[model samples]
Target: MQCMNWKLSDIASVLAVEVVGNPEALIQRVITDSRIASTGDLFVALVGERANGHDFIASVIEQGAVALLLTQAPKQPVSVPYLLVEDPVTAMQQLAAAWRLKHQLNPVVLITGSNGKTSVKEMVRAGLSARDGTGVLATQGNLNNHLGVPMTLLSLRDEHASAVIEVGANHVNEIAQLGPLAAPSVAVITSIGRAHVGEFGSLDNIKRGKGEIWQALPATGGVAIVPVVEADSEFDGWSFWQDALAKHHVIAFGDMANLNVNRGWQAWVGVVERQATTEGQLVRLATSDWGEATLELPIAGAHQANNCAAVVAVLLASGLSWQSIQTGLSEAKLPGGRLRLLTPLPDLLIIDDTYNANASSMKAAIGVLMEQSAKTHAFVMGPMGELGDESQALHEQVVDFACEAGVNAFLASGSLSRSLVQRFDVQRPLADLAVASEDAQRLAEALWQVYQQKGSMAVLVKGSRSARMERVVEALVKLASQSAN
Candidate 1:
């Protein structure tokens, strides 16, 4: 994407700054890191938790940055054009909003939640692109944090009619900072769960933080696509929908309810019942939007149905016809390592959900294994992190859930996971489970042997980001490749 030419005056008004130096200095790009500063780029010096961007001003200038946006006036100002704002972080957000308006592109959709945000974003993108000459831009990987949000906005191009940006935060105010940067024409909150429960302290704080997406919606008129999760219901009275109604105007896609999974992973949904299935229920879904189609999704577990529901709502809100939405969803593919199915060896089915795991996601993975009627299901679950003080209890609870779900064989990794081994012995009459050290490499070698011997069993591998569960997935893939040849 070619960078647009920007002037000091264009950015200064949005930032409410008094341009100091040459106002005519042309900025062709905006950058935050001094290392990437290039000729004609505007270096935005933001204050972060670890370091202040203002400290890198000299280096940014040395690298050919034409302008700077800083919170405080530099002790020794340089000849380069710069804008002094009270808070560079806020200034960056305002500037992004202004830049978005200046481009006159299609509407932007912002997605946020503790879980399933990325998947829903992709679903919406697919649904929208199936119709019109839609160009979809989304948050790459997990760059959903404060710094990541603005960087995603800066990556937008003229061809993009709309963007699906994911917003994530562990503390208060993080989402607030990201809200305006994307300036979504429609905002979607997937669901509020126990993510970052340590920092947020209670579920209440998580709800409040997620609510920031609603507060960020532009008043000129916008749609808020909120899943009818229990926590989200609390804010229903104060949502943007009410504000839109007061103007004697309503968005065409407002308040989509009901979703039913039809013949395959396909679903039929109405706006009202859409929020009802936010928890868990596997039902045949048909929708007026996507007429008479059935979809059995490639991904496992019933929770995915809920995630799909959110995607459906976002697509409908974006004005996609039922046929296009159904086609896009039917063609949707899962991300690598996110419940990716490796080649089957003999009767063995390997499920690699090792990308990341939390309690809720873990349960979903286990559920998939339990549903395989004819196969003995084995689970290799590594430690799920960020549970804070509830880590032990939560890990133990997983062991209990696994037993109840009828998981035939269980392997626990990590120091915290060892607790599962201990609980399994006491909870079950026979201690059939194995405990691997926190080292994933060693666990991978051992799991391969188990797979070779237990030829007919289905195996599931899962863990948190820090656990490196991909090592196990790689081992399985290698074994499958060798067997095929």
Candidate 2:
């Protein structure tokens, strides 16, 4: 298959920027980092907090960049083609939108919500790849935001048969802005929770903000793969998707007990049956259109079942057979730092779910920890940021669940750690439970003492992105390696 080539003139026309060099220079890719800039590439000079892209223009040119996207003109005359705009980030976004509008890729699936967006995107990409093997372009890393979304769309090439775009937002209307640029044919709403309540102000606002992606669907032949939510549940007072469900084709998944198949909403449904397996997640999914199928998922967790079900719904909606969908889902692999296991010592197992956290995610991680068949279990907690007014209450709820769930230790860090320690002590005193310390070294040392005295143990380290709770995990790994020697 041939690569996509965007001429300098065409890109400049789309970006509405001032060109400084050859207009006919061919471009195959748009890059932001100078370290990876190469031939036939358009290097976008983004002015970030730490570094300015213009400072590295000479290096990118040396790496054979065909064009430069910049916010200001170069200090000296340059031979390479360049487009000067008021803001390079905005210019790149505009170009990415124009590129998607021009190419019109098929089966463009958009996944959005508070949590599980990345995992669901990976599953859908794997499922779509099973369709033919031409190629499926998907969002890489955490590029579901405004800048990241555009970068993913710009990466679309000729060989790619389909695209799975992950659209993310912390504030209101962010998805509405990125959705149109993605131009998705199929839309999936993972779940609506208080993931970024601080930015949204309320759980109600988060529901409305995430629901914006449904607006980008095509008039006809559009498909929606959503969770099974009733008026009392996920769809409380949200009538937009209700109308879309009635008009467009639909595939819904969740607890099978909550749905009424006899009510004539025969949209295909994916359900994770009562798992009877010992180790892996046994997913028994039953869909009306595609019939029933059973498969063992690679990862095991209560939340994972819902994500995999959503993946199956997307694949079935894309017209893939049950066999192909199952094949793709079985081979799916999500990003690291989420329920990933790392054994720094022979007796210590780390449950790394440090990607990001909310009340829902925290509880889910705790559930994963409880499922482990280890001699001891400890939780290295961190603050849940951007929770707005409900931060303390929601965090207290997480603490309540951890204590009620029979956890042996709960060591918290961050600004909220002291008060949480008070709360933890009130619920389960230090005499009855393990100690909670403020110092990182003391925290790690205490946890190590408990594990060494109790035999094999599992530690769940998690927090919001800003909290950097991974430091605790790093410290533990270091101590374990040092002590083992």
Candidate 3:
């Protein structure tokens, strides 16, 4: 959309491919799928483990794709412009680099970690916008994997001053491929947690995957910002944290370091102690640059403070003034379905955080429920996925936290969560604990019945993506709407 039209030769030179077709062929757009190919668009046929893009070449060209970048020769020769490369994925990365240089855009910031990447990206976008009113582009959702990263960069426009790309990986070497394409001027590792530890095998592998963000930093003096972790935490092995400190610069925040939550507001004021290479921590008083002088966030959670802290670090690192940061923070809202508060009913408040769930996020949501002044707190929880061997243990841990947090009514859905509820009953007698059958609909209906009988209550709905917790949210909202009618 930013008036991108590069010569075939230019792209060929960047990708180091032999241009065998029309040298003057103009490519205004880049696409991976044949169904979505448009006129004058360059279709990059990447070969995946399951299917090869070369198989779709003829179909894509038939759909008005002007050119193709292929890893292998086409079986049937179509008189279309083409570039033959050893690897189309690598070639796409090369094209992304060339496009960035050609547009002269602001430095890209690459963000990755086991948790909080999306939140950090949003914060960076907000902070950067406050500083310069520059056109900013960020990943739409959790589109931070290998295919998602290139697609995000390809969506960039010449008018955009900067881009914040979120990278997620479940295995090793994933971030290594994404780093060069993003070409981050600054890299931020949000935190290392057991997000996909099952796929990676161990915590060390998880650290190795997250550390790729730092490894991708350009040797030309790039900065890395890492949050301060406990001395005993495994995150100390973060190469990005050490590498930036050794060569360029590193900024650290968090851990009871003169931080305060702005009362009745979303904004915060704190003195961030600048940790010099030699000096440990030195105080620099700073106020958030974005949002109301005092504001409240739409989403409720204690971990939000940590998420906000990471955002604060990104804004400060980006050179935004304190006032701008405050303004931006005030303006920021939670991404949809991440602790989204539905309208208050006469007797209940609905919390729809069903987008996804994990150990840390579950604790944060429960903490928010604990702080609310409700006669009773009800939770409709589903299983958390991808924890590998720790799935059952993690579920039990959440149940223990819930019992300790004083949730009055706990409705566990999903077989795994039901198993956790049973374990909790054996370990600690929870008076109001109910385990629903496999049907999420039946669970929602039962919860609605209880809410109708009770005069006042609060509800939290949460689960992994596969659990479709949003459906439960919809059912509850529908019940409330019908009652009003």
Candidate 4:
């Protein structure tokens, strides 16, 4: 964080709050948690579900916070300056919005979509940072909400040439409200899928919510990066993205032939040539300005090819060379809990994609598992949450894929996992039995026994965040380690 040195009067004026402290006092830092407050920090006392920051006013003041941003004035006498507003959170957003504009941070990228938002964000950060003497600021660890966005903006310092902010929304008007705050120079919609369909009601609504990022771009000089889709894709067809973003420059990425580069639109045309010796894929990317190159991504799944293509588009929009993009992507690391490969035992390969799950991601992970040459392939899956009415059918559909994908054995856990087990019929098809357990630990034990009897197999572990499916990975790793010792 660069030295903000914002005056008390400036903060109060931006928030329209009543300032009671020395007006000339400069605040070098903005903090929400009292525990992190220092001498020159402005601590925001927000009201949350578990605890109210208002209760810790005295504690923050003692910790050397020069000023306080509060929704309500404290009951006791306070020595430091305090700005009382109707909502501390909104005030923080306003301050961040003002700060971003004042600094005029160039080439800010705002990324949103149903899936691959984090991966794209990390890729952009990696791609940009790999450039000579480049400093980037991004949302830390999936902090993509209203509060998280503002905190990210506040972290923007003078040295930061670019900022990659991930904006996530489950309902209507959420992303719409966030767009104005960030005011990104470039907006990216990774892909519109059935994620959070329960909250948005349908794919159309999801597209509408995600499109808000494009709407948030500046009137004259903004750019939009979107996935190239088929002519009759479900979400892209109704999105009318070209019409919605008619004013801004649009860059699309996907299949080389399918991408619509006509009518002055730019494209990152690419294809996954083949899977590499590593558990990764080789992609050939070609843009108008930056010529073609075969990039090796140390990540699994064909879906990643498109995700990396989107990153390529973002980088090209930022004026990066093909070589730079390749270097950054090659060095980019996929975060844990998302297609992360682990080897606990000599013959056992664990794909720990347990971060979150939905129908599309589930199928993608399963595809990666089946792509492997392991003699036996197994899946430890949990219920995909927030799928609404289609949750049961989606769960069943995944199991059908498992059965047809040549999965040797599998275990289903969580409330919806029972759907897969109930749908499984050994009499009709596969010789192996599908285990149905209520939780990860139980499934781990059963899976361990299967591995004991079967020997040498690849395991794919995945589920939604609510399922905490990473626990299954932990359990299996522990069992393997004990046996190894």
Candidate 1 lDDT over 296-377, as tens digits, reads 4444566666677667656765677667776776666667767676655667677888888777778878877766543457
RMSD, every candidate, angstroms: 5.8, 2.5, 6.5, 2.0
Model 3 lDDT per residue over 333-445, tens place: 65877767776486678888888888767877888767666676887888788889988888888888988888867777776766776766665564554655567667767
Put down candidate 4 lDDT per residue, 403-477, tens digits, no spaces.
777787778887765556766655225645478887677878877887788878789999888888899999999
The Cα error of candidate 1 at residue 369, in Å, is 3.2
Q: Where in model 1 is the C-alpha error above 4 Å?
A: 34-39, 46-64, 70-80, 84-86, 103-107, 132-134, 218-221, 229-284, 287-292, 344-348, 372-374, 428-432, 476-485
lDDT of 2 by residue, 192-254 (tens): 788888898877778788878778887666887777656477544245456656656777677
Off by over 4 Å in 3: 46-59, 75-79, 132-134, 234-244, 257-299, 344-346, 427-430
- Candidate 2 regions off by >4 Å? 1-3, 102-104, 234-240, 244-246, 261-266, 276-279, 344-347, 430-440, 482-485
Residue 410 deviation, candidate 1, in Å?
A: 2.0
Worst 10 residues of 4 by lDDT: 424-433
TM-score of 1: 0.80
Report lDDT (Cα) of residue 152, candidate 1: 78
Judged by whole-model lDDT over C-alpha atoms, candidate 3 comes out at: 0.71
Q: What is the lDDT of residue 384 in candidate 3?
A: 85
